[model samples]
Target chain A: MSVTYLEAIREAQTKLLREDERVFIYGQDIAGKFGGAFKATKGLAEKFPGRVLNTPISEDAMIGTAIGAALEGMRPIVEMQFADFSSIALNQILNNAGTHYYRTNVPVPITVRLPSGGTKGSGPFHSQSMEGLYSHYPGVVVMTPATVEDAYTMLIDAVAIDDPVVYCEHKYLYYHLKADALPKESFPVGKARIVRPGRDLTIVTYSAMVHEALAVAGELQRDGFEIEVVDLRTVKPLDTQTVLASVARTGRLLAVGEAFPWGGVTAEVISRVTTEGFQLLDAAPARINAKDTPIPYHPNLWSEHRPNRKSIATKARQILQE
Target chain B: MLQTAQRGKKSKKTAPEKPASKKGQVHERYVEAFRWMLTARILEDKLASLYRGGMIVGGVYLGRGQEAVSAACGIFLKKGDVFGPLIRDQAGRSAFGEPLLDVVRTYLGSVKGPMRGRDGNIHRGRPRENELAMISHLGAMIPVMVGKLLAKRMKGEKEFVGLTTLGEGGMQTGASHEGLNIAAVEQVPLVVVVTNNHWAYSTPNEREFACANLVDRAIGYGYEGHKIDGTDLNQCLEVIETAVKRARAGRPPQLVVAEVLRLAGHGEHDDASYVPQEMKAQPFAQDPVARTEKYILENGLLDEDKLKQMRAEIAKQVDEAVATAQQEDPPYPREEDWRSMSTDELIDKPSF
Candidate 1:
């Protein structure tokens, strides 16, 4: 079952809808008539009919409906048109969906997919990386897939988790890569994966940053610096041991993110490492992140606003005193 | 189906609901429900006394004026049925076979209480044995419950109908419209019970909703709306049973307006000075529980001599539960220990 990253996700969703009659996929312009703004859910509505629901411009209702359906033993996966629009539904997700289990012990199993991060020039309203807010909320399992395999498997895992999950897909990576047959069964959450191995430094990150870290590591290899990179697939149940162990041997750490450096996953990982991996640190831990501001419209300014592979390489050099 | 759009005035149906239950229901069950109502009333008043003392931690949201509203909606649930209740739904749970002891324990805030004392005052965690969980958020559970009812309907199961309770205060919440609108579209079985006590913590009902009756608000959603005399226990019983029966038949959703009054301050901590003096006297006339007791005596449903024994027995039961709850240790996170379970992600953690 060879497929592109985009098709891999679509295949997983299409197959799930076919196999599990209780599973539903719905949101604004997502049904077959509109085929989603990205065309990932292109033919789902025609195949499933009423099951592939098309929603109005209401995130609150869209999320609330999916939540209701999930509570009644029906598995519902809701796609927010853009990650930025999830603000309207954040109250439901933060106050109700995510916190339902810890507050009331009532299990609400639903998957919320956000076309997250930036590279495309959709402007601030349409293009924003807002995973920090979701990560800030407790009881939510957060996912930012870095590979085609992860893009496919995380959707299945998100549905299987007893708690609600926010599966953030980097929109830039939609047609960027391909892989053969993502393992469809038994994908686990809270587990990080080692994408590359080196001994001088550990590059810890997730989502698009995983690609940037890999590129930075490739350039650093010319300078005889060995970098170990681990992709933290899920941010909430952060895979601390795999990261801490890698940094313990490497003696240096660089956490990268495309989101704002302040209050992002970078800050979270740094705090964790300073506490759990304090002895392993050779130099003070550092993070490379996007400038602390709203993503702008101009292609040049947007390029400057994002933390790229160069930013990772420069930060790694600064930490290593290159 | 009676498809009229008026409130309470149902379209004249040629056939009334007659479920094929030839088992012949007992008369004692209705009497027992009346007894529970009486017990809930007296218990609310007494719980205030306990609140004033150090015996109770959180002040009770005394459902003093809305006792009959609870009684009417809860009486006839069978096994596998679920009720989504709000914070002040003591009478509703009591009607659903929840133990008096557990309710007392929850109110008294004991470690052995439901949800392990994580929820207090206005949340539901205990009484899992009855299949009803407490909805803590404001009208957030409406769509969630309707979705459940939708599932029951789609599967062609008569086993579950979502019984949801909210104060008229939360009626304006968006989830209410979303829940009711979709429930109507899909013809799902759901009963929305709004206890309009006329006060959403000092805001008048007139300020909250445009219509005088909350049931009127349900019309736009294609619901069969009813405005019942919440003070009239008999009327409440008849109307709620009708809604439940209609819901079971997949006749969209029904909105019931139970106009109630608050006999006391909202909670133990809330001062009564905020309430207007004239408003308090108005509901006293329609004091539902008092009216029911008078009717029970006038109708000779219970002997005057037997009433004394029944009151004494119920009083003893409530008092014992409260006493046991108080004597038991405070909740897992109460008193000196505000919360033993604060996650690393801090939101509302208590600090000394």
Candidate 2:
């Protein structure tokens, strides 16, 4: 049976609840039969009993309470119904949880699961990639898992790390992406994976955009140009070494992300390459992101707003010709 | 003490009657709470002097008039219970078992303090001991305390309650609303004490909330509400002690709203010229330290000679803490680790 990305997330929570007494799941409508907004916590609430509990519709309190629980030696997994709503809890998440360890010697081991990125018509409020936003803060590990194996293992790893973690699981890939079975082991978090190897140019991306980059790599293969793809499993600790190595081999770089265009993950990747690996580039490095506007509701407008295979391929072709 | 027109307005809600059987135990608690309140008052006075003398680096906030309520919030908590104290909670912190050295060392920027010179002033806490070092955001600590109680429950621990304090202004925040609702929904044994000191920084009660009283929010949020005149140590001890006991007995979360007027400016920097002199003459403006002292002497809780001895001992302890903290070195930039994340291996080193 094929394990989907969403199923893998459920399995990880199941394993955590079974093994660790300190681990508990707290979120809105995630208990009893309601499960969660996306059912990522389905069946587990019954399976774990009191360990998986529902919470009030208070995002600020959700994160603040998780931080408190973490302080009291509990590893809480908080699920934001959508990535967009996490903005309401920024004070608790960024200031309280983010600054707690630095202010005190104690670590806060809380995992905030943000169902991130755009679905076809999820609209401005629901469809947002917040990894870039959360990554800007210190004391938080931002994980944007692109595959089923990484989704399961990275989540488990996120809980083990003694700091706040923002796990940005792409809403679009929840059911669409699948694997043969959950892997016994996976690559360590905060490392990049070379999904496709090439020598002509390197495409650096993460989350749902990894699939788009791979599709562009396949399209460019028929055009007699080799394209490399690097999936940044975790964006904050950002495996810069892997990206630099890819750039050294390919001699060109293009960072792609689904977040808005203004200074996010894509911009950070380009900034690092230009500052450190400037000599590795045959031409100036480039990046592609969603238009600098709120994500639209119409399918056509939404398609144009975010980076996709068609746009990535066109950008790749132009870079190869450069 | 001068009584204003507003003094007897809320007198209808009188102090709970002291039980005849528990008179000695109640008297002993009164003496202990009084000692803590005195220590906090003296320590804050020193801090204020330090701020004025330019020995201290940050703002100095005194729990000048709110000590009666603040001490009561802390004195009732047990070893396992959590206490989240805000800016004006020094008395509560002392009663909750916070070391005076921790307070002095943090203010003096000594590296040996609990904050280790990373955070200074009121943002100091020993979390392992369940004393939450509060962030400056008002009402933010409420949810954190709720979470702590929830964790204890999940661990199958019993009879432990968590308490947190906020000002009249903080009670209006969305964080406070959410935190209160969740505590009731989970039925966690939590006590929230809102000391309405008639001002939040510079904002008055009228600007802070529209409710007749802050305690009015308790019933709507499914809490057992209690209100008291904060200046009366007897009323504060009676009301807060009852709220804590009710929570420990598995009742709904308890809300204790104590009313007092801020006896000093928001901080040492402002002279508080904006406060109307008429409002200052109100009975709620009675200094809790002086009032508690009078209660102890008048009721013979402690004789005058013994009270004097207690005050002298507390002063000596405060002096030693301040001197020791002053002698200690502040954190040096070169020696500072400067790392925020606890997971050391995850930090990226410059590969180039």
Candidate 3:
């Protein structure tokens, strides 16, 4: 009952490692020496000495190795110290790992997890929600977990996938959550979960945004505005049906995410809903997302860049009024 | 954005043994390697012709004088021993038993082509025969091969090792450095084959790097390195065998620098007009396929008539594969092939 988001992710790794000898974990500062910066893999290196690898300071090599290993029937889990640094291995991600399955017609079951989103006062390089750009690559699966249950459950689901996956974990969400006993068995990915159900307005979000949407919903509910929070667990192959169903029921939609406003994940959601679920929407989909600028170091500036409870609440009200 | 192509697996009927190689089989092992080399030479010559015409789009870096490297390597490689491919591995692919017609069809852009005609000559590889496609980006395959080698080790496959090939120019690139460094420290079961032709495009080896020979660089990286005459198929074959043996025995990687000559230009598109006519002509004197043919003919290993029969067989097979490939259609994938996939779909089942 005391499963934290970090613990759930670790439990998923442990379970997968124990069950599947093909699955392995590797990255810089990982392995037994450092346990990773966030302790996401504290015991993995010790538990599985040969499987857990600590590599040189080369992101391209790390990703390329994962792809190569995956090609040869071994599932590799690669961790980017931070999400934004993932750009260094962009070629490997898109060209090699993502396309290896298409080119060779063999599934390259490699998983890349990035400690992402704005937190820790680490400016530009550390705090980018690159969901939009990543979603553009074909043959890759992207995951963003909100609840601790999802954090644990989504990884099990990810492990079962035969293709490459880009799993985004918010740096802030690691220790700031708790859930019931995490599942050690297989789970499903690609389906969006309804985190907090409401009938007045549907709030579509994921990762840390789910928490923000729920917090805002709690404050707005006392004042008579019910909000449905939808956790879009996977970005690519988006759960459009859940979004449309929620939008149809609520008649108002607000996409909340800690990502950019222009051409962001929210934009994709709003675009899809408007095209298909146009008549059902009482108001045009409103996006309560991060500002279209690099995350600032200052706390308030960082807060300003990302959508918070007040912002989510304001957007929910605006949609209701419309 | 130089993107890597993606592929998913499918269960298919076991591919039949290629008849093209069977036609050239005269019963002896080394002679069989010579016949395979003849097939590669003819296929490569045909590809060179295709590039000269308007058919094959991206020209290939021909591995002409280095036929023995391909001939011997093709014979020595066993099941699960992956060949990472040199810029000139079209021969190696044929030797490793990538159905000769399929190999020819790949060069001809046929439907039966390795990548379903989606991949040009520069991007060819197959998992079935354990020969990775030819990657145009030099030295990029080194680290990838090492990683695969490590994976095989992890899977408890002791017989599996990686053979990564590159040009002499690749010795100077960061790819060679990083790849060798990682393979060295990790002791990845890999045989980094540096096919030193003594030139990088128009630049000579003296101007390219400080090291006199590419093998010296590997020794500095803390691995045993050997320099072998690329023209001698026996030498190259024996070198790879020793490296493979050492990798399996000591569980450490080795480097084999195949010293050959760039018998032609950098690619089929580039005429060797830039190369000093002397260098090209010198290496041509001891053409690998020719040298082996002479070895078999002069030593009474096989008469000229027998060699003639092998060449004729190789030519007929190449012609058939080329005709089939020319008639084959390009790959047609679904719309999802052009769109992003979800984690579940990427890992489990995405409607490909």
Best by lDDT: 2
Query: Candidate 3, after superposition: displacement of residue A176 in Å?
Result: 0.6
Q: Summarize candidate 3's per-residue lDDT along A1-322 as a digit string, tens digits.
A: 4888999888889988999998999788878867897888888988987988888766776777776787788888988888898887776787776766566666678889988898958888889988777887777888998777777877777767887778998888888888767755533567788878888899888888888888988998899888899988888768888898999989988888787777867888888888877899877778977887878998968887888887778878888888
Interface RMSD of 2: 1.5
Give, for candidate 3 chain B, the lowest lDDT window spanning 10 residues. Answer: B1-10
Using DockQ as the measure, what is the rank order of every candidate, best first? 2, 3, 1
For model 3, residues B1-352, the per-residue Cα lDDT tens digits are 0011111231122221222223234336667778778887888887778777878766666778778886666566778788877667767777777776666566666666667666666577775456775445556667677778779889887766677777778777665676677776677777777777777887887788776666666546766666788887666665666666656554346777777777777887677676666776664336888787877877687887887888888888888877777777755665234422333343322222
Encode model 1's per-residue lDDT on B85-113: one tens digit a residue: 77556677788777777677777777766
Q: Write the per-residue lDDT of candidate 2 for residues A1-322, one digit (tens) a residue.
A: 9999999999999999999999999998888887999998898888888889888889999998999989888999999999999999999999999899899989899999999999988899999998888888887889999999999999999999999999999999999999999999979878899999999999999999999999889888898989999999999888889999999999999999999988889998998888888899998888999998999999999999999889898888888989
Clashes of each: 1, 0, 27
Alpha-carbon interface RMSD for all candidates, in angstroms:
5.9, 1.5, 4.0
Estimate every model's Cα lDDT from 0 to 1: 0.74, 0.89, 0.75
The runs of at least 3 residues in candidate 3 whose Cα sits more than 4 Å from the true structure, single-residue gaps closed, are: A183-187, A260-262, B1-30, B51-61, B134-137, B169-176, B198-211, B232-234, B276-287, B290-301, B327-352
Worst 10 residues of 2 chain B by lDDT: B1-10
State the DockQ of every prediction.
0.32, 0.73, 0.34
In model 2, the clashing pairs are none
